[model samples]
Target chain A: MGRKRTRPDNIRLTEVAELAGVSPITASRFFRNPEALSIGKRVRVESAAKELGYVPNLAARALASQRTEVIGVLIPSFTNNVFSDLLRGIYDAFESSRYSIQLANTRYSILEEEKLLRLFLAQKPAGLIVTGIDQTPESRIIMQSVDCPIVQIMEIGPDPVDMIIGFSHADAAQAAITHLLAQGYRRIGFLGARMDPRVQRRLAGYQAAMKAASLFDSRLMVTTPLPTSVTLGGTLFADLLAKAPDTDAVFCANDDLALGVLFECQRRHIAIPKQMAIVGFNDLEFMASAVPTLTSVRTNRYEMGRNAATMVIETIEGRRPEQPIVDLGFTVIERQSSVREP
Target chain B: MGRKRTRPDNIRLTEVAELAGVSPITASRFFRNPEALSIGKRVRVESAAKELGYVPNLAARALASQRTEVIGVLIPSFTNNVFSDLLRGIYDAFESSRYSIQLANTRYSILEEEKLLRLFLAQKPAGLIVTGIDQTPESRIIMQSVDCPIVQIMEIGPDPVDMIIGFSHADAAQAAITHLLAQGYRRIGFLGARMDPRVQRRLAGYQAAMKAASLFDSRLMVTTPLPTSVTLGGTLFADLLAKAPDTDAVFCANDDLALGVLFECQRRHIAIPKQMAIVGFNDLEFMASAVPTLTSVRTNRYEMGRNAATMVIETIEGRRPEQPIVDLGFTVIERQSSVREP
Candidate 1:
């Protein structure tokens, strides 16, 4: 082959085919399905395409000129296991489809989510999967203007641009607290961090349950806006205990916090389930192996991700979504950490 | 203002301009720099472009037809802290740039990596950052053919495809083993899981250190192919303790495994640093918070990621790489988990 030429994107496909000594149809076939061509023709066509700076995918690009085959997904947190598990499920669902997810991390900030949304809107993706229902007014207006299918995940809202796939955080948190109450523990304290929309919803859930049981106490809640970590768990639990020594059980917003709470209890010689019954959310792998084996709310994050992706793909392929609002509810797993013996 | 029309791939840009009652130059200018035109002109041009299915970035496409403003990143694992830290660094480096990472999870399978590479190659990304150096032969050939800049990360290899940014896992492992020997642990053991290339290299490092000390014993090492987890650490440590009851110290391949070993020690009432000592790799966020703060090799994953991205960006912008092979190296941290009492 002669010296490699830059993309003569200036030339036509017929000219490119002539340069490669092939028919226009053959050159077109090479881009769509090179497997159909023999090795000799395939190599020649590729070399000619490279030399001519061939950009044959234009037809394909034009086919979806309004929107690319990208499935734009927005999550509030990147490192959080909750979102990562959803990503795993999303990947699994789109694994066989012609779609690929364009992931954006919003740092659990509505402003950041808004910024990311504006950027994604420019691309006009085939569909979008967003986290939570709370969006800036400007962001919601943009969402409403877009004609493509949109799926809001992690929570259900009455006014979705198109669709939603998630459960009630309030109900889940209420169930966790009720579980502790049913086990005969009152004066339960809560530890929370990174008070994002979901966490706020969970707190509301906790408050509602406590109030219904005539045990609501603002002094029992310890919270911070800082990102959650194993150490934060200990710090928050310590704060809760210092203020409410009468605290008999604690419900952690996340497993990381629970791990910290467990470690703090171990350090203070506070007996678990005997003196303090603790519970966590998300039911991550470590909860099962903790010293006392922590109890946690088990939500089907993978299923949510998978279902969301499937919904986007089906909608993009022109299949009407059977349901616009899907509530993949949560379940609380009874483990040793939160269970007490009479 | 007209009814929504599909991309008319067959029509020319001039017809689109006339239909929207705008000059062809104004239509072209709108796609090139919409900010240059007034809001009304911009809207008209955009509608014309939409109605005609105009792909106006043709000039921009020709300028970089072989690539887009995307940096394709392929990693063996996604949620792993080690890789996540690297991602944070990569993002930090590219934070100010026009580039965004198009991440693909290979899940530690070479075939999957090869498959992902083929798809990315078709997109003709601006650059690529890949994990490890052990790509399939077929994959390497394709990498060689692609003219875009490529950087290999996570391990410093003698023969890199183009450029490399990482440290020596074997050396780090040897250092850990040597640390235990200095602490007076004679019957030290090694526990590893998900023996990927890096894990195998770590095992090599351990063997090298033990052999040099005339303490090499295959019976002291326990391994499995299951993905690493805290619970896996406990199970593997149990197997090691069962087979070699005299085992006084252990070096874990990853933090998850180390956490498990620590938990197991706690469960068996084995006093850390008294009856047994432990060390882990990757010094994750939880290492310092563990019951007996775990000692570990702190690899500069974030820095490596940042450096790799910086290198790719500079090279793509036509700057010569100062050094094609960068070894950031690793550090061993001393903590209570591996600190023997006097």
Candidate 2:
């Protein structure tokens, strides 16, 4: 066979419109805003476009309308299930609303986050969704300069740049601590990974609760760098036990770390909720499946994503969301890991 | 005290250029492509832009440049550590390359994938990174219509649209079966989740290997529609035993299911390796840490993401990648779960 013949190019809007019995202007308008046309006409244009294998030149559209229908999402890491789940939720919500999400991860570094933020701004997303409120001066300035909706997720802070959709990390921490205190676990400890502002909020909340219950000095708090793995969690627990021998309960930064601590305790033959109790944040899937079922705080990770996407879409459409600060609450799931009695 | 006023509206590009003693055109050019201009002039424009907090309108720039510099990623699920790790690698590789990733999940549905593909096309990403080769007719049309680079990941196919970047699922399956067969396990069985195209590829591969070894009509293939949860895995194993009473070894779709099977076997007092041997795929984090370290196929999931990202970026830059079809090799990690030799 002769060299596989190449398909002809230059299939234009005029040809598609002609085939569909509509004007080129109508076809252009159909792509720009299909909702504006009648259903019959819209269907016809879509079919014609599909038949012709049409891909509208988005660059031309962007230049004409100055809207790309894309949003920038910057987070610390994707390996963290919490963030990944949140991203999934956002993707789902955006998909339904016909928006696309662009992602950047800073790996939990402010300097890196600053660089990513500048890059994101240069790309000109219709909106921006960042992990938390804390940002570098340069990043903050760039965010302020961008004329797009801003959303800070996973943590709450005073005076958000524009919109904030997250829970009070401090409040969740305090509630976790209070639950432990009420259970009569006086010897408590806090095991955390990373000192990102969000984690710090949880730590502050934990401290406030301990001090309020007159157990501040009695409790031990261990803070490590951000993004701790399960192995690190196991090692951190061993380290904590060596220093605080009497610790009867522990609050971990998140479930992965908590699971690690639990595994370590099991290895040491320590009876859980008998010799010690444990609680974790971000009640991920493994938490429920773990041998004893890990006790943890369940944040609405999916809802966080959905709400953030909704807020961004609404902002892009010039429809201000009624509530800028949408707090999808967290629940403390009491599993065998933290239950002291029947 | 008087109510604290919100910060004034952000400074525009004109204001920054005027303050920096340059035309708006020069300032815009400096921001659009900094590398092309003189370093001193670029620095001055950037400093002035920083001082004025001028953020470029990305939508407009994208329109003029005909490149969004964003990659669209379509994944199956983020909750799975394999996919999450892969995404993390992709995100890391793309971090400094001036390209962002837009993610969508198909929920393992071909129809949903088609919808997502159409949505991705509307946004006009610079490149596309999708999970598998399986595509609905409409999705295939959209993929073919797109004028940019397209990379199909996770599972390889015989024919790729533009580029294919992932391990061969069929090869991985055959390798696992071959390893078990070598260990003198003749009465082997295969256990898997819902039959997706990728899973089908593995199943076909397993069957081919079994037939090649003269084990056709063995009645040892067990399939389930349930997710690879621990409880589900246990139930699946129980069912498998009831149906194939003489089966000596089983290969699971993933480690999660394998772990479940292991848990059930333990509970039933069936001696591992002595009574039954098992092999799993994906080599998730918990596999190595399980009570009996799991025997699994170590697919470089993270590297898959990194490679896919690299290919997309290269395609966007008009650079031909060294190879369009990259088969990052897989290895069999022999652990206690399948080791039977004394």
Candidate 3:
């Protein structure tokens, strides 16, 4: 669809340059690379541009330069709090920079991600930050062929497209299980929702840890393909209790589920950490303030996002990161929810 | 910063056209206006493009047409669950459409919104969906100058730049208070954080309702300019108690604070509804599933987002909405948290 060309009070760079008593090139340089311009010229251009309400034509500039000052970020779910924290870090990193972010939601679909990737690449983004390491063969080929630096975030794995930043989800889950085991809780159960690639890995880690302790039982785990929510957490926990009535501890895939389990326990008059201990992943802000101060695995989500964006920006500006793959790692934060009274 | 123009295996549209036995114009038409092309020609062009691995250069198309198939969206916060639900609706609305969203976070600053508005206008987006009604005077003028359709979301007010869709926050808060009043609760207090314009309106509503009952006391309220969180909710609730020890009910600015207040009440061994009633805004999923099920003012956030995007796209496609200003409204859901025993 063609857009209406009705722009009132259109201001030109040449007009701003004339008003500021500077060359058009100087004014352009003030917009593009202001550090290269003299202080006097930069100040004059800025003031004149402000006075004229001159907005540079980014579309034309993008065509001329064959690239946009846009860093394309592909995230799985907008509703997930995890990505929101990551996005804050990404936005915070680019706040003062010239580049603006163009975000796309893949809805946790690899095919959708691939499609979005194609669309983003067509625009010739300055750089890209994709969600995870798992990608289709065609998508990987497309990414490898692109010249801009790319960062795969959320989990670190072998053979990254370019740079990678994230911790091991499996390791984080295993640590949470280890903490529960050390707290003298046995017959531990697993509760998960929307078993995405990362959640699946977490489940794998839980199974491994339980198996190592000779406590692994398929009946102790309950999962649903429905999108994760607090309500779903309670429902899944109830299902887990029905399937394994003697369950002493529960490990949730995320904090929302853990919070749900806590609420369900309170409703059922079950004393937390005495009858049932709870552990969750992604120690969200609410976890520390919950009634029992829920125990959770703390992943460096914000730092991962910030570092990934910085790496892409640095590579774009000619400074490559010394470490191409960074595993920020995770910590199992033990709170009152999982601590038993000795 | 200049980019490396090293796109490997660059496939030209001319080669696709030759392979498809069609003119380059037909190949180009397939990407832009496929509906206008004959089925045979469209099929041939699609296959040819697929075989050649041709990605249409969006920058070049944007320059040629002077407009992009981009619908710019600006939201205040990324971490807030309220906006995340809104974003999901917006993304789902644009999922199958040719237009992609270019999201910008203003971080609750009107000045930042103004800067982002200017940047978005410079690119000549096909349409725009901006959050809230409180835009800077210059920003308003800039939006008015642009030809693209703009929809202001999150709150309905007088004097929209183009179309508008949202409920009244003040009215919603007033309703929540009314529900509490009807439940036989008096001496209600207010808990707020992040005092944004919308949250301020909610506070105003709380004050108006309290004054109507002639039970309003300045000491019965506690608020902070700090960002709202569950932890902050608990801390503010504690402040409210210290300021007004006789407070029997509390209305939180958002669900996070409400949840925090619930957790704090649990920690303090205060009976919910019996000792202190709690009501929250933005009925998040966790509200209905909490131990005592929380009461909340449920605003049509997802519908607001979907309707706003649809309005923008409809206007861009040469069809104007019959009702330019839409107030979707809100519902005060009564649950165990606010219902006192008969």
Candidate No. with top TM-score: 3
Candidates 1 and 2 compared by TM-score, better number: 1
Q: Tell me the TM-score of each prediction against the true structure.
A: 0.86, 0.82, 0.92
**Each candidate: what lDDT?**
0.86, 0.81, 0.92
lDDT (10s digit) by residue, model 3, range B200-312: 99999999998998878999989999999999999999999999999999999999999999999998999998999999999999999997999999988888888888898
> Candidate 3's residue-wise lDDT over A1-342, tens digit each?
765777535587888999999999889899889999999988999999999888887777786777789999999998999999999999999888878888889888999999999888887889999998889999999999999999999999989999999999999999999999998999999999999999999999999999999999999999999999999889899999999999999999999999999989988999898999999999999999998999999998899889999999999999999999999999999999999987
Looking at model 3, residue A42 earns an lDDT score of 88
TM-score computed on alpha carbons, candidate 1:
0.86
Candidate 2, residues A1-342: lDDT per residue as tens digits? 554545336356888899888999899999868898899889998999989888766566654554566688888887777887898788878876645677777888889889878766665568889988888888888888889999999876677888998899899988898888888898789888877787888999999999898888633888788467776677778878988999999999888778778778866889888899999998876677666677899899889988898888888888989888888778998888788785
lDDT of 1 at A115: 86
- Candidate 3, backbone clash total: 0
Interface RMSD of 3: 1.4
DockQ of each: 0.30, 0.34, 0.73
lDDT (10s digit) by residue, model 2, range B152-208: 988777789889988888889999999988888888888888677777888888999
True contacts kept of each: 0.25, 0.46, 0.93
Candidate topping DockQ: 3
Clashing pairs in 3: none
Ranked by DockQ, the better of candidates 1 and 2 is: 2
lDDT of 1 by residue, B164-228 (tens): 99999999999999999999998989999999999999999999999999998888999999998
What does candidate 3 score on TM? Answer: 0.92
Error of 3 at B236 (Å): 1.2
